[model samples]
Target: MTSVQQRTLYQWFEESALRQPDHPALEVGDEVLSFAGLRALAMTLAERIVHKHGRAPRRVALVASRTVAAYAGYLAAQRLGAGIVPLNPDHPDQRNLDIAQRAGVEVALVGGRSAGLFARLPERHRPTVLELDEDERADGPVPEGTPPAAYDLDGEAYLLFTSGSTGQPKGVPILHRHISPYLAHNITRYGITPGTRLSQVFGLTFDAHVFDLFATWGGGGTLVVPSATDLYSPVDFIVERRLTHWFSVPSVVREAQRLGNLPLGRAVTLRHSLFGAEPVTAQHVALWREVAPASQIHNVYGPTELAICCTNHRLTGPSARWPQYPGGTVPIGVMFPHMEGVLLGGDGLPADEGELCVRGPQRFDGYLDPRENAGRFLSYEDGGRAVAYDGSAPLTDRHWYRTGDRVRRVDGVMVHCGRLDQQVKVRGHRVEIGEVEAVLRRHPYVVDVAVAALPTDDGETELVAAYAGRAVDPAVFEAWLGDQVPLHMVPARIRRLDGLPLNDNGKTDRNALARILATREGS
Candidate 1:
């Protein structure tokens, strides 16, 4: 039996491919790629890449998705020890080009009809583009010779760009060592096997896709890819494909419930259900459990810097009760066995309610830019006290990465509170934007909500709440909101919308909402 510490991600994928060469590895619609077939296709592409670039390219950008070539190109990059920079073809041309330039990519594999995406990039900033042919199936037999060891455990594996507070995209470089343990832990913990059919619904840019790709391939399970339409009606897709594993953000569950897609008592083949990337509320879990009663519900939590997820809280059975936290969300549970964690209050000491900090083998070294590392880590002293974080000194492995997420122990389990930055003062009273959002979401008529601090004409900050749900009079909702919370915590403004705007990664776009408020104020 393979242990969690035994192999790297690529090694595990190779072993799975070799062990089950004829098993189904990747699937989309009616198309399926056997392990042997996908490996052969990847090797052919790897050979072509070596021929063009002489040596393995340092980094490769993939402008494709929902195709065999995309997965093959990803494996090809791994075979060459090149880091991957995924460029979503559906995203704006400028965004894709920016990512390509920021990652310093040497080549980009344009899959399917996405070749035109690279043409928009200026000649000076563009990497060498290789477009995939219309037919992506492997035509030749498996390659004979074994590829050489080109990747180191410490080498960069992928570069993911997350939106920064400064309005620019920050690159998060994850190394091979940081990801191997994550993959191993998930595969073993989820009991993934050759028979397990996992869902791949997240976009390539979202960090959650990391679990979708490696966890399936590493455990020799089949990765079931869904079309854009499948996402709107995920329950149908899950039922049709008989998927054994389900993983996505809680928003998907809420969407399904809203659309009347989650029919009660509809049995599913899912054995493990996981949600991450946002707070998972008990209401969302109840909806999920009602649909898939046999599957174990788990709320996984982590940031991109800590790999796919650092902790998970599992509900044993459908009848099992869910524990609610202070923020009206599910408890995030304890840290994974391979990770270390601490919660530090504003005073820089360990506290029951504070910012969560972590340091372990799964933790990445630092951001791509040294400047972005400022105040992102903290030194710790005796008694697990976090010392001051010096922006002047270079960050080292000894420093704990500050996650910026506030958490508290609730009934012996760590529960997510909100982002530390979400705190804002109104009339000398501190209010958390997330707390307001959480409170509003509990309303029977409210489906989704977001609260932002917008400046008033009087040079003071006002709490503005935007929500999407059944139609109701604004005055009535405002009066009802006031009765539920303190006057200072109540929103000064309430705006109703058809739905909360979501970013490319599917999280609520608070910045976009703030812009709407600012536009209304100007008018």
Candidate 2:
């Protein structure tokens, strides 16, 4: 009997393709890659990797350009029983190489623009690069000599890098078992079946990508990838692709609303839009309700460690915002079937406001590189005499991914308060205090930096960055950052502090930083 560990992702995908070869599996612009087409591409690539590299859990970093092609190479790596790492093309060239090296990446697959950057990395750290371009269009057969490593269900599927407050990137592992529940959960919750067509708008590295791919496959639905330009523009490809479901960060939907480009009523094919990756304000929900009255708008709430989503709040008529929201009905929603959500109090007991801890099938078991960094969790107990209790109750359910987020629990619904740590939510995206510091400290003029999240007057989110530098051209520094990071990652309010405020423990005091933001807003 081939052990479960021997059943690699490629083997699973190839089997799926053979089982339903004609099904439309991926749609990118006018190009559609069927299950069979994707399988063939992945298989040929996997065979090539095996024939050349003699694969043995070799880490393959994919610099995805075309969303569909990226997905293809990712699947190919999985088939080879190799670990897959997806790099953001937007990351600074040095930052990208640093991350890839940290993950022990031995081979890299990237697009044309990303190609030149990887070549600059030192030879010892640089991996064999695979470029995905129009030229790689030759569809070849999988050779008979290929040695496909047996898939291990217990083996890691991929590594997702998270910037912690320590100003370092940690790789989180997603095993096969961690990926399966998404398929099953969405299939039950979203009615995902092979007949459905789901929209993919968010980045592949984003938490939502797990559901974006698995839900479609689990329900036997087609996964559609929109063109990068069309996605950024005021365009809706739902009708063109005959997509029955859509899921993305609320920003994309908001963009459509701002541009008056939505076809909600006339293009009534969409069944739902699961919005996450940021907080959805009442105003954001109402806009969707105004347009997609027929299509369900679901609020998905979950951290990256929790797979993709652990709960949902389906949008109906804008419920009365409560003290928290307009009607207080703005909810993080109920926990998924297999999850337990506990809203703890400051003392670590059940408080209306405290840290939200999630435990269930979706919660990622552990990080590939574990950091016992005392930051991600809130071990209640205000520091007990026993030394184990942090003056809080011990979690009774299971191992909790102490989401350093502050939220108010209302009748079991978790309402986000902000952060339990310096981590801030800017424009609905989680911005680590450490990520900005990591970037800023790398600048030649910078001695140190402190990044914080501030609220804009429109009641929207923005970032407040504080840096200590040796007096360089301010405009030049700003311009340098603009070229390196995603536009959203840039801090809105830059305030240089003499030094980051540290607590007695020599750790950045997030509470103090939050006070700074509040004081700045007051002024």
Off by over 4 Å in 1: 1-6, 120-124, 143-149, 422-523
For model 1, how does the per-residue alpha-carbon lDDT over 282-368 read when each residue is reduced to its tens digit? Answer: 777887888888898899998889987899998866545555557567899989987888889988998899999998877888888
The list of candidate 2 runs beyond 4 A from truth reads: 1-15, 138-142, 233-235, 316-329, 373-397, 442-449, 457-459, 468-471, 482-486, 493-523
Cand. 1 Cα-lDDT:
0.80
Candidate 2 minimal-lDDT segment of 10 residues = 382-391
lDDT (CA) for every model shown?
0.80, 0.68
In model 2, what lDDT does residue 142 have?
A: 48
**Residue range with the least summed lDDT across 10 consecutive positions in model 1:** 1-10
